[model samples]
Target: MAKKLIAESAAAPESFEQAMAELAQLVTQMEAGQLPLEASVAAYARGSELVRYCAAQLEKVESQVKVLEGDMLKPFAADGAGEGMQ
Candidate 1:
């Protein structure tokens, strides 16, 4: 069962949202503290892999955005204040 869980999660999804949803589910189940020790371990491992996958996806997008912006990446501000802001 653990192997199967790991195998299923090993396949990358077409979208980051899908991976995040699945990762959230795994986290919920693991946090519930109802799974056997082996299953918990498997879930944790899958979660770790999902995290790495998500990070890679984000990094790719960030790189693309930077290229589109001519590498002039600006810091994001929450108070409506930053570079290029009036």
Candidate 2:
């Protein structure tokens, strides 16, 4: 079980979207209560790893956005008219 989790985490998704899709699938499987105890534990561990990876990716993107915005993070406008817009 540990080996499988390690392998899966090592592979890690290439993109945040891919990771999120896999995590969603894992959540659905776990919620169904069909997996045995060991399998469930493994899935939980993998899901945790995915969560961390997704968060890190988000933070990286946010940092890039801040840099593009001159280090000033602005609130997004719901109507799509925000900073840098005429």
Q: lDDT of each structure?
A: 0.82, 0.83
- For every candidate in turn, the CA RMSD to the true structure comes to 4.4, 5.1
Clashes of 2: 0
What is the alpha-carbon lDDT for the whole of candidate 2? 0.83
Q: Write the per-residue lDDT of candidate 2 for residues 1-86, one digit (tens) a residue.
A: 43364456657789999999988888887898877788888888888989999999999999999999999987778556775866
Q: At residue 19, what lDDT does model 2 achieve?
A: 92
Residue 53, model 2, lDDT: 96
The C-alpha TM-scores of every prediction are 0.76, 0.78
Candidate number with greatest TM-score: 2
* Segments of candidate 1 deviating more than 4 angstroms: 1-7, 75-86
